[model samples]
Target: MSLGDEHDGASAGGGGTGQTRTRLPDSGAGDVYGVYGGARRPARNSRSLITVVGVVVLLIAAIAFANRSGDGDGDGSSSDAPAGRAAAPTAATGVKPVAGKNGTIPSGYAHDEQGAQSAAANYAVALGSDGMFRQDSRHAIVRAVHDPAVVDGLLGRLDTAYSGAFLKNVGLNEDGSAPDGLTFVSRTVPVGTKVTEQTGDAATVEVWCTGLVGLAGEGSTKPVTETWFTLTQKLKWTGNDWKIESSSQKEGPTPVNGDNRASTADEIAGAVAGYGGFTYAR
Candidate 1:
């Protein structure tokens, strides 16, 4: 079947939809606080501060306990290990591919939950990268990550989604061009991943992601907005590899960050142009 046909099937049976869903605002480029006026900073209170501190301590302790508990089933392979212990490379040593392969695609995933997490994380990075700004590159990315059955339909819809108007709304000029002397960047960095459910051949992986999306140009209206999103992929082990059967994204499990210095356009542009993406592995 074509990509759109597959999307229809997945949507029909509610197969693609999962427990976690992304709540994206309809106005993709507008600020959520704009409708309600600018966001008001909450006033500080000593009592409130103390309560927050206490909660933080409890959270930390809970995290520590979860890590120590190793709640997930531990097979000989490291992929099924719990998130707490499976997070670090050392703990996840057995699951890491012998070496990165498939050009930029990480290979040798351990055919387990950890492997699904690794795939989901890397896929999120690929899906949200600046490469999606260009039509040709975007097609390549979707084909590479999506199951073969859905490639054509996804390509068509994505072509519409990344049309001239959408590009302009994303602060790009017509034909996906950036304003002179500026760069447009969109990338998702995975904060963590969890296997909500998994069987041998089918698995559901949710990647909690922090993304930066906007144009890095002087006088730009949207200057590098940050967002948190969770991407859940229903994966199938096909042809000796884990391929995305279907996936969806939703708003966040977000935490506010303290104020920090913003970088210059030059810095952001240089970093993006100079650096390259890694071949992620389990």
Candidate 2:
């Protein structure tokens, strides 16, 4: 079974990375895919805790781009030669290297295509994170990433979807916290991003992601595991930045299992705490 199947609500941030957005290529290199202000999605053909969690995960997550300067004008550089060629006036984001935060999530993205991709990439992290398990953080995330128009309705639905009963089934306490000795993990890291469609006011982006879910430590039935999925986010220019409109997800472009030895729960927990998540999501 897939890692995310049994555990509907997935895991965290603070792992290694930055992701540039682009959809997966047809070659099976990756499979692909939002945030809160997000509209209530139309009922899907398939529905599960994973599906709900996947969609919800995108609703809260964060982003980071390695080669690109997130702080500048989308120009290749901060000051030097306008970073190769300056963006055409119509396309120039003027604001790059997104800054600030919305609660613990990233905020203040540029107003261009790259910005949309970055916002989607980063959002997936929040969506698939451990935050979804708890009520307080979950509410804050919904407010930060979602469009204000849909937030009220979407909030009610999400509360029902992530009920205490659901959390218990997934091995979490009713409060969405891990068992006293266990470490819960549910982090989604974007592999890449692609813009499938775009217009002046909106964009549809696909983010291919690798996610971690489950728990670690003694007596834990839900061992932390990995997952692959693609998420599609419908984004709109709202309140000066891209916010979620609607979203969807589907399984892999997953790779074959590798030869690497799996880590112990302690090791996994250590890694989660030691490493840092990328900054682009903001």
Candidate 3:
């Protein structure tokens, strides 16, 4: 899709304030993709029903499983009481981490819809970052952000995408390295999040985001371009924590931007490396 399409309702901003003047085409309520503000109808494929059923089954299973795990009361005794009663306090008690403990990453996300939003936002930031462009850092970033079940698959594809030849195509050095005196930048800033559906133990959150990606060097071919995307995450409360189960992303609800002076390569690089990333709380 075109970067500035109005139908998708995506907007671009000069800075991180998230102000946008454009309006998106309206689709009536209850439309799936309409959540993003587009009129385009979803495909009338046979898989739609199957997909819905599968999601329902999964949700049911997750809720049941989470409920069956009795609350910790020192002595392990099972309770058949309403699952909601037990799950509520556990999910509610955890405080969202305000600052990163050891580094830039935020910690202490509460195990609820808010925590799911936090994870989705931060995960989006990690996924769209420059770290995904290098080999070792790419693996670290993916492992840190993705759900365990899909980590292997995601890592394999990421490895291929950031392979030596691919970096060359993107004007990087043969070893998937950046040229001297240049810094490549990639970062995603989350705009907002909405909990589409939520239960005591599970939640689905949509994180709208804007991303900057490109090389920053003198005479660079693609000097810092911008794009928008929304990340949808399914989160489950596991091991007394909230963890992402799976996530999918799509192109923007973007708007146009006013002209602004671009920062120098060294400046952008220094900011990225120097400034720490936040651990988000919804």
Candidate 4:
């Protein structure tokens, strides 16, 4: 996520972060694709709607192309050529998954396409977590997942991005905590991952995720809400592992919302407390 000056602004500012309007999904609808943080300007105009549709179409096409199976290639290696089409992005590369961690972030990712994809997914979860709002946790996460060259700059920018005012806007105290008798909920669950581009030394991967942000409690104005976005990370092999070189986010390849009742704040809090985050792998 690009870090913007404004709290609602995802990571960075400018043309890519999206608009500044808020629209609650119809609880009756199916999976809601939401852009978390900042104000997202709703696409009321025809041109804006068209642009969103175009983006959705392109993203879907890219994902489909990435996931397509090889054409009777005996070996399912990702490096294998698939005739006229693009290489299958998520095809297994027969590499071992990393089995280690540096602090909370997974370490030792395989130095291949699968490893890159895996690194992207796990990093997505960390970057989107509530921990990112806390100074210590944010530093650990940045050090764990980001390339050494950019870590210092990223930490400085992020520290400013999640400043006191921003935290207040999102219903947290100055130190990224709920006042009392409330639970702060900011989590990202990656549904799946794709390697949009790859090489021996670098890769660009997209992680489709559903996230929970906001607070949960009695009379909480910023009630926990879910968001949908595809986080694209440009990763490089560094110190024998995949580390984030750069990252950006965009609103969804979101599916149509389904008919499901929205959970109450208490129920949401309970469920969150009962669950644990996963260590994702390709």
What lDDT does the true structure give each of the candidates?
A: 0.57, 0.59, 0.51, 0.62
Q: By the TM-score metric, which is better: model 2 or model 3?
A: 2
lDDT score of residue 147 within candidate 3 = 49
Runs of candidate 3 exceeding 4 Å displacement? 1-104, 259-282
Per-residue lDDT value at 221 in model 3: 60
lDDT rank order: 4, 2, 1, 3
Which candidate ranks first by lDDT, i.e. highest? 4
Top candidate on TM-score is 4
Collision pairs in model 3: 9-253, 10-253, 10-254, 10-255, 11-253, 11-254, 11-255, 12-255, 97-108, 106-279
TM-score leaderboard ranking: 4, 1, 2, 3
- Write down the lDDT that model 1 would get: 0.57
lDDT, residue 77, model 2: 17
Per-residue accuracy of model 1 over 1-282 as CA lDDT, tens digit each: 011112333332111211111111233643211000111223333356677788789999988987776544453333353445444322354444536454455654667766767777777677666666677776676666667776776566555545566556556786777888677766667787777777788887777777666667667665565667666788888767677877765556767553345678767767778986554623
**Model 4, span 1-282: residue lDDT tens:** 222222223343110121111222332212111215422223332346677788789999977765564434332335532245443434434655566879867788776666777788887777667676677877787788877887766566566655676566666788977879888776777777767677678887778877777778778876776667777777889899888776666677766543345688899889878997766535
Q: What TM-score does prediction 4 earn?
A: 0.72
Question: In candidate 4, what residue range of length 10 has the lowest lDDT sum?
Answer: 13-22
Give the alpha carbon lDDT tens digit for every residue of 97-206 in model 2. 56678877777776666677778887777766677667787777667876788666655555665566556656678988888989877677888776777777788777
**Worst 10-residue stretch by lDDT in candidate 1?**
31-40
Greater-lDDT candidate between 1 and 2? 2
In model 2, which range of ten residues has the least summed lDDT? 12-21
Instruction: TM-score for candidate 1, please give it.
Output: 0.70
